[model samples]
Target: MMYTVIDIETTGQGNKITEIAIFKFDGEKVIDEFTSLVNPETYIPEYITALTGIDNSMVAEAPTFREIASSILEITKDCVFVAHNVNFDYNIIRNEFKAIGLEFTRKKLCTIRLSRKLIPGHRSYSLGKLCAALNIPIEGRHRARGDAQATVTLFQRIIDTDNSEKVFAEFLRRTSKEATLPPHLPSDIFNGIPNAPGVYYFKNKKGKIIYIGKAKDLKKRVLGHFYDKTDKELNLCRETADIDYELSGSELIALLMEDAGIKQHYPEYNVASKRNPRAYGIFTYQDRMGINHLAYNILKNAPSPFITFFNITDCRTYLEKICVQFELCPKYCHLQEGVQQCSHYKIHTCRGVCINKESVKNYNLRVEQAISFTSEISSNKIIKKPGRHPDEEGFVLVKNGIYLGFGFVENTEQIINTEDLEHFLIRQKDNVDIQRILKRQLITS
Candidate 1:
């Protein structure tokens, strides 16, 4: 079988190809070679120039990708594309072809994966490092032709390794995911992911979680990331080297787990729920005249808040609703400030408490009633769901309107009350995002 060992230099941010090289090998011998510097038609970043030593001035007079496209297509036709990190080179070429309204498809192989299979026990599989350990000299480290040529030598060595024929066949099988997975990711790690509801963590080489996602089918969802050609997905896949997961037993629990993981890790790729939102609280205070007043403030200053809200609008809206419902004065609820007597345009059910038309004892009773009503609305509850496995049950615990967390209990365990669940409850912080997730589930259930 013919294989085209390839390498490319690209503008990092935009990923526009700046240079490419291809060496066609006929199993035992290098039969043909192609190399070119292409004008990327975009500004190359300083870091890329520093790495590859190929700058704007160097490529200014060179042919554009369109000019060399035909050469690339002709040289690589009917050959299995080979590269150190094959997906990076292959996808970039595919994307370039797509931009020009063409399709570039080929069965591909990653020398990095192959080396791990055939050579084994290497500290690293990067082209330069692998070559250094093998004593294979690379004339130019970052330049396309030099890297491609070195890759050709490495490919030839991989072909000659013992049991290479069987290894190659397995990797080349149509059912194999060897070519589709991220270069640094192990096939076994992906293969081990179960097709069940869970939260998955994508970690970089240093074992730091970079992204977290929840899915009803963990395997399918993680595979979808590899198929996505969007720039963000591509970048995310490129950096992922390991994966970790927690079975959630159900979608609701998966979502909760995902939120908690993202909040805890503050992963680089997780844009939402990474920062703590400002919290507003509804609280009550007793005045000198023996009247109880309802108010809202930032949580830090709100002593013993009756309820919490993430934004001023929601807090004020809830307060307004309770004010009108309980016939409490808007002035005391803090809906309108600097008013001697409550004269709220929307809330006219003040009962004259603001101007002492109503007795303090009567108004205080109404305020207490409103507080009790709020508590009743946010009562302690448990949402039961399917557990991670048979004979077990999953449940989300909410105590006094705050989400405690999710937990699993065996079939024989009897849960009679909120206190009964505390032993199995995995406590979690309540936040705006978590509230939003639970609200949707509560609404649906």
Candidate 2:
């Protein structure tokens, strides 16, 4: 197998390559080599010169990257590029090619990753540190050729071990060409994406939303779609033509917007964001005995639910927890069935409402408390969260338990009254998902 071990020294801040080295090997030995100081055509920082000792005068008459670019490509062609921290070196080279209006891509292997997997017990993977530990002498530490030679030696040592073949195979698999933009989407779309929390809309050629999503970091999440191999992810990448976003200033607002946007647009590719199919709900009823009972009903014919749940298991789990907390009867809640007192009553966990040992008024009082606990969460109030800026605060407004939407308030005192908060809030439509998310948040908070 052929491998080209490579390394580069840059101008430090903007990362223009000032020097680069490549050693082409054919498994057993170095077959070819290239090393040069390149005229970055830009000023090299004083600190970079101190670290690399390659100053302005040294590279003044050296060939520019454009002059040597073709030679670098030709030597490394069809060779698996190997380096310590391959991503840093590879991206630097690829981007240099890109600036010259040429696209360059190559398979790469990182010795740092290989050493961790194969050697396993190294205290450090830094080139100088590792070479010192391995007793591999390296001269001219920061220069490109010296570092590239050290990496080549390290690669040889790793390839001689018993796990060499497996390790190399793993490297080959990981270093495959990275995921790229889909044919329908231009690369410039990513240039405009911000790293802030927001909701992103993926649209097709006709300007229709194909998917809607929210992320704590918008750029990272959208880029993740490009790299993901899942069928749904691939479909989103393939169908997307343009990307749009709204900064929510906070994750809660982003989530709220995501929920409403999905429902509003009903995007074709967003299956997970579509309305829930489960009709499971938690409800209340009064039996003939004038005892109130909480029950799990599947689309149960009640006028309204105490609160909707996604499934019977969730509904039952919630009811059980509420009953346990309030010391209500398992039988009264329909969690247990029997002619005599329920099991919870025997254990003293139940307040004997099932057997009428506890007065109807007292037991029903706790039931009312549990019902009110959930019902009141839907009540009007300002839900505060961290804002985009340190001096600002974000809030979600829920009036009488119906979500009014969200907004940012700069003056925290403005949130003390609903009338003032209304001036800030941007209204959002009410959807079951939004309601459910808010319900969960209120319960947890």
Candidate 3:
């Protein structure tokens, strides 16, 4: 097998390649070699100079990357690119090529991954540390030629072992899928996603979650990503190493699970997750004359609110709509301020609790009716929704005005009574976010 072992020294700031070394090997021996310093067209930091010992003065007279791009491509033609951390070097080269309006792609093998598989259990997998642990002699340390030579020796060791060919075959088989993977991903992570309701997580290679989302059909949502073609979506696809998911039996469960996961993980790409939870609430309290008043407030330790909202504007807008729908008094509901009778009452839109034209008892009852769907004091109820299977029925149990949890009942006998239903329920913690999702589902249903 033909392989081009490469190492590069950069400005350590951007995609600038200052010096590079390449050794073309054909299994048993090195057939050719190339080494050069290229002007990076940028200042080299003092610390980087101290490490690689390649000062700005050294590259000042060398060929620029644009001048040598053709030669670099010519030498590596039809050869597998081999490097310690292949992604870094490969990306740098590809990006530099892109600047000159050229597209570049090549089969690659990372020695870091290979070493971990063939020579396991090292304290550190860094190039310098690995070479030292293996007792391989390295000259010039951070210099391109020195590191490239060490990598060559390491490659030779893997080849010299009795099981070397088998290991190479296995490595090829394992990483074959990775060749087509997006630059930001690890493998064919999209393959296993199911076409079901759920929450999905996007994680980088180290398993750090960076994005979270939910969908009624997970496979379609994930596939939608590939067709988006937006810069953000492209960046997400590039960095995503894997896709993790939880299958929910119903849309309500998916919505609740997504909110909980986003709150817990605070994923970088989930804009809503980074914001405060349930920013606004629709609250109700009894006035002095025994009238129930409804108002909107910033959500903070407000217990048993009627409904929650991410925006105060939405809460106020919904409140107005509810007032009109239920013929509620605007003054008593706090939608109109500091008046004997609200404008709605004069216009005959409100029932007139503002001036006591409507009795307090009747006005309070209307307020209760307005928010009955989401009222904290509503009677115990069951919200029946579609289940995972056609014969099964999913149900949310609210016991004594508190949301108990949800479950799927296989038959009428399984849900004959609350006591019988508890046997199949998956108990869930009650929180404002979950309550909002539950109430919204109930109201819409």
**Candidate maximizing lDDT:** 1
- Sliding window of 10 residues with minimal summed lDDT for model 3: 178-187
**What is the C-alpha lDDT profile of model 2 across 1-445, one tens digit per residue?**
8999999999876678999999998878999999999999999999999999999999999999999999998999999888886666777788789889988878877777677667768666678989999999888899999999988899999888887897677547743322244434544676688999999999986889989999999988888887674546655665677899998888888999888888788898877744554766677788888888887777755446878765566667677778887888888787877656677533347867776678898988999999997777657667888887778888899997789999887855544578888988888888777776775665446
State the displacement of the C-alpha of residue 174, model 3, in Å, after optimal TM-score superposition.
12
Candidate 2: pairs in clash: 378-401, 379-401, 380-400
CA lDDT of every candidate = 0.89, 0.80, 0.76
**Alpha-carbon TM-score of each model against the true structure:** 0.78, 0.53, 0.57
Ranking by lDDT: 1, 2, 3
Off by over 4 Å in 3: 9-19, 36-64, 116-129, 140-143, 160-175, 179-255, 258-308, 311-413, 416-445
RMSD of each: 6.8, 19.0, 8.1
Full-model lDDT, candidate 2 = 0.80
Which candidate leads in TM-score?
1
> Candidates 2 and 3: which is better by TM-score?
3
- How high is the lDDT of residue 216 in model 3? 93
For model 3, the local distance difference test gives 0.76
